[model samples]
Target: MKKLENLQKQLGYEFKNIKILNEALTHKSTKMPYNNERLEFLGDAVMDLIVGEYLFKKFNKIAEGDMSKLRAALVNEKSFAMMAKELKIGEYINLSLAEENNGGREKISLLSDAYEAIMGAVYLEAGLEKVREIAINLLEICYPKIDLTNLVKDYKTALQEITQADFGVTPVYELTGSSGPDHKKEFEIALLLNGKEISRATGGSKKEAQQTAAKIALEKLKK
Candidate 1:
């Protein structure tokens, strides 16, 4: 509770219903009665609205597609997790021992969901205007960190360019394997150039895997 209070001060928003705040920080894996799933759902909608409105007003000259892309870049799991880390929100999150042992505190999905839940809690606490204020404030903090140039590149194109420029060979991607339940399966992908492995990455889907592979290749080459 002390941690949450500190977080509220840091975030510039106080909850009218403290229970909601508590619930927002509770992970579903704990099987807690007041889990954050519902809040996460509502927060997802609120986030889309706030981000859409911000991008629409801020980038008036940008095309709808680009605006949408920017919004997506801002609201994804990776960005949300990064934001959560910045806020030190992970310290306040409540998770079961099993989850905590498995690195739930640092997990992107949990962090992102917690971020959404906080948004939902804010919306419920003070309405859209207050939520908008917090959302915009956070957006300001996040905007500079978003690399739009890198965000705009497609995986295949980016990988090709990197491999071609770096090693003078076209990059090839192979579906190494996939596993898990249908709803939450993971895919492993490997990127190769000139018959040598450049990098490998895993993701929830094949396309994501390719993008992650490309991102890994980018990091390797950038080093």
Candidate 2:
């Protein structure tokens, strides 16, 4: 109860219907009577609209495709997970003991869904204006630089950029290894820049590992 009160204070918006807030943080894996899936859907739509409007006004010359990609990057699951971590939201979540033990609190998908559910709940408790303020603040805090140039650029994009700009040859990625339990396997990926080993990284998924490798390569090239 005290923890929930502290969380509410940190969010700066007291829920008129606390149940909505509770529902938003509930994960279906816990077999809870209520989950935040519906709220997550609604919040996703709301998030897109807010981000779209912000980009539309700020980057007037930016194309629709570019704006959409940037918005997606800013509001992605990983981004939400970061925000949840910052807020220590996992500690406040109501979860079964087993789920908690399995690191449910730190799960990216679950945290992202909870973030969206909170948005939906806020919109319902207050209004669009309140939710908009919250969304803008959250985004601004998460990305102080707001560099749209690389916001949505993934490992594939980075590799392509490096290949075109430097070697004039495309990079290739190879799966080095995969380890860990089935539910929590870690992938090892290596990216070769024009046939030269550039960087390698490990992640929970192949795409993620590739992205990490590309990111490291980008940093190395920059340095």
Candidate 3:
């Protein structure tokens, strides 16, 4: 239809087999025999490969672990959903009446899956090169808006790396105390670097408090 044609124009790849494109847009909620699930699965792998290769080449000097984190940040559901939203992909999805009423079009999971399915359809119709081109173009548009450095920084992991690299010792997180009622208890945690307390933070849970403390430690160490 007109909508499909417009989407094809937007994607810059006209499908030889429109059925595949239609399948990509069709949600499982429709209960249709042909849906996007299989395409989504294929696309997920394809995306991982493409993104991994991209980061590997672009950040050639970076370590494998750093590249992995960058790839994860780029290919996550939230990032895919943002790309889909930018493309206005939700308007073209074929959802069941119930799903439509429930605002399925705006659902991040649905949008991300559909975007992946569309990528799969593109790959099947065109080729890996063509799909890679499309992905790179989209990523180029998205990259400037993303904080690549922060995206790869897991507080605890960052703290550990810093401590080990600088002091030749690992960072440790200790639960210092807890307050409030049992159900709503808030935990206080401290980060220790080489047996010396570096920072402390409070959060609703021990893990959160530890992360906060780690973040604080990282900040202070960097400063």
Candidate 4:
């Protein structure tokens, strides 16, 4: 077995009970005496509480709905996977021969679960405050890279909310035209509100074009 001392070094917290750390890295596919599922469950809840508290305190004036969205963006599987990759958690993960042969080490779901399991183990061996410090340090590294504007839901939804509130009607998107080859095509889209064309934009796909149009419309509406 590879040494976990490097993982502990990366985490900046050494486990007094190293067995717990091993269990955290063990997947169900390994058919070990103990696996990470229980630890993952605990870690999930711990993460939620920690992230929610952080966001609540940090974004004091932000609306609850917006805060919820930010929390979701932070605690999501992709975010966890990114953190796991940064920590090289995959290197320490224990998988069966079949799973290893099938490239289980690079699987995002497994990495994310293992990350949470490690957190749970950290909490168990240390305490909530210790785990919280580690989690916050990881999140600090992650938070700045995230673009909150892009993380907001599709532009159409934002446009709909603005139109509904201001005009008591939903905005509509129309495919204006397309150009180029099918594989590399570009689409043009227009946004209409209450039967009046508000804005138009182009993108690499119909969805992207529509979003661009909606974003343009939103900019116009906000002016």
lDDT of 3 by residue, 1-223 (tens): 6679989888999999899999999999999999999999999988998888888787778888778778878998999998888778999999999999999999999999999999998998898999999988888787764445467666888788888888899988888899999999999998888789999999998887888898899899988
Q: RMSD, each candidate, Å?
A: 13.7, 13.8, 12.3, 10.5
Please tell me which model should have the higher TM-score, number 1 or number 3: 3
- Which digits, one per residue and each the tens of the lDDT, describe model 1 over residues 111-221? 999998998998987889988988777777776654445556476787788678877888888999999999999999998877788989999999889888987888888
Best-to-worst order by lDDT is: 3, 4, 1, 2
- Model 2 residue 3 CA deviation (Å) reads 2.5
- What TM-score does structure 1 among the candidates reach? 0.69
Q: What is the TM-score of each candidate against the true structure?
A: 0.69, 0.69, 0.71, 0.71
Per-residue lDDT over 33-108 for candidate 2, one digit per residue giving the tens place of the 0 to 100 score: 8888999999988888887888888898978888888887887899988777766788777778888899888889
* Structure candidate 3, residue pairs in collision: none
Candidate 2 CA-lDDT value: 0.83
Model 2's number of clashes is 0
Q: Taking the tens digit of each residue's C-alpha lDDT, what string does model 4 give over 139-166? A: 8887765444556657798889878988
Ten-residue segment with the worst summed lDDT in candidate 4? 144-153
